[model samples]
Target: MSEYFIAVIIGIVEGLTEYLPISSTGHMILVGNMIGFTGEKASVFEVFIQLGAILAVLILYRDKFMDMLRPEKLKLVNYKENGLSLIHVMAAIVPVMGIGYILHKPIKNHLFSTNTVIIGLLLGSIVMLAAEKFAKQHLIDDIDKITVKQAFLVGLFQILSLWPGFSRSGSTISGGLLLGMSRKSAAEFSFIIAVPLMGVACLYDFLKIWKLLSISDLKFFAAGFAVAFVVAYFSIIWLIRFLNKSSLASFAIYRFILAGVSYYYFFIR
Candidate 1:
């Protein structure tokens, strides 16, 4: 198949899975390996496409973000004591960004494999299930009401997502629930924080891999970015609606199935 065709396929996978509880990294690893697209360029392409998904979030939540950018909210330490602000999101991103930066090379070197992704998926599934069963609080339903403590704890959970198949949305949403956030609120915060997490991570990766790209690869990358952007926009909309009336239990089950299938295909085969 053409590389462009492969890019499209990967873009679809990234779009559908990126913000879902399902691990986009795991799916991309499996699909990339399946289609013989596993390599440096492919890795860079995957990271590039994530920016598209981040852009979707930025546009979808433009008003919330604009509020965050207000002059008064610009102070690094200033934030509403009870109301959500830029500080809440910062608290949620700091832990992962710090740890991820320290362990970047080691993680890329050792944990970016299919076997590890399977393990991550399985472990993440358990975490989600446990969070659902135990979190009866559901105290905070409004995103604007998220406390710094809650956001920080959620950020700590976001660290788990760096494990490739752990799923960033899964970790944050589960953490949010365990910390007393309603499902819809948790999901919204997850999507909101996802923009910066993905944006910084992708930009960092792109800087490292820019030399590997060329003008000839432009169309391939563009196709993947555009498709991922469009699909992820709808995915976000659908997920918020879904979470309002549902739970993360279903996604946990899907992770179990994907874990089993990925293990069989990649390691057992």
Candidate 2:
């Protein structure tokens, strides 16, 4: 297949899977294999193209980003009163950064294999299903009320995404719900946390493969990034609106089906 065609396919996969709690890294790996883009190039592409999704989040939440950087307006208020959600976000990022730093090479070598992806898909689906069932009984009603303790717990869960199939958004959001954060709140927090995490991942991957990249390769990467950004921006908007009125059960069901199908294709059948 042509490089441009492969780039477009990867771009589509990135846009769809990045925000859906289905593990964008897992999907990209699978798609990369099917499309004859494997090994280090595929890995770097998967991470690098995620900049598109990160940009989507920034554009969608521009106002929140601004508030996070400059909060002098509420300096007189208590920590919780000054829109300190951003600080909690920073706190939540620390564990994953530390863990990821420690395990980066190992994960890239062994944990990113197809078998690991399959297992991640299955296990993450189970977790999502259980979280959905729990949400029905104990729904969190407010996002602003999330405690630092709860944020840290959610961050811990987000660390699970270091595994190929375990989604960053799914684990963190589920953690938020379990900690009594409302679904919308959980989802929002999940989105917010993704910015720094994905940014770092993209940068790490690029630096790793910098010597291998060519100008033509950069063009393809930019094309993929642009496509992903447009799709992911709309997806973020739609997901937020849908979550306002719906349960996370739908995404849970989707994950289960995806996992089952992937297992069938890769192992059983």
Range of the 10 consecutive residues with the lowest summed lDDT in candidate 1: 75-84
Model 2 global lDDT (CA atoms, 0 to 1): 0.80
lDDT tens digits, residues 1-269, model 2? 98888888998889978987888888887777666799766766777778899999998888777876775624435657665466677778989999999999999889876778888988888787777777544445655566667778888988889998999888987887777777788888888889987888778778878777777778888888888888888888888788789876787777667777877777787
Worst 10 residues of 2 by lDDT: 135-144
The runs of at least 3 residues in candidate 2 whose Cα sits more than 4 Å from the true structure, single-residue gaps closed, are 73-77, 136-142
In candidate 2, the residue pairs with backbone N, CA or C atoms under 3 Å apart (3 or more residues apart, or in different chains) clash, namely 140-182
**Cα distance off (Å), candidate 2, residue 267:** 2.9
lDDT of 1 by residue, 120-161 (tens): 999999999999999967779999888888899999999999
Per-prediction TM-score:
0.97, 0.92
| Clash count in backbone of candidate 2 | 1
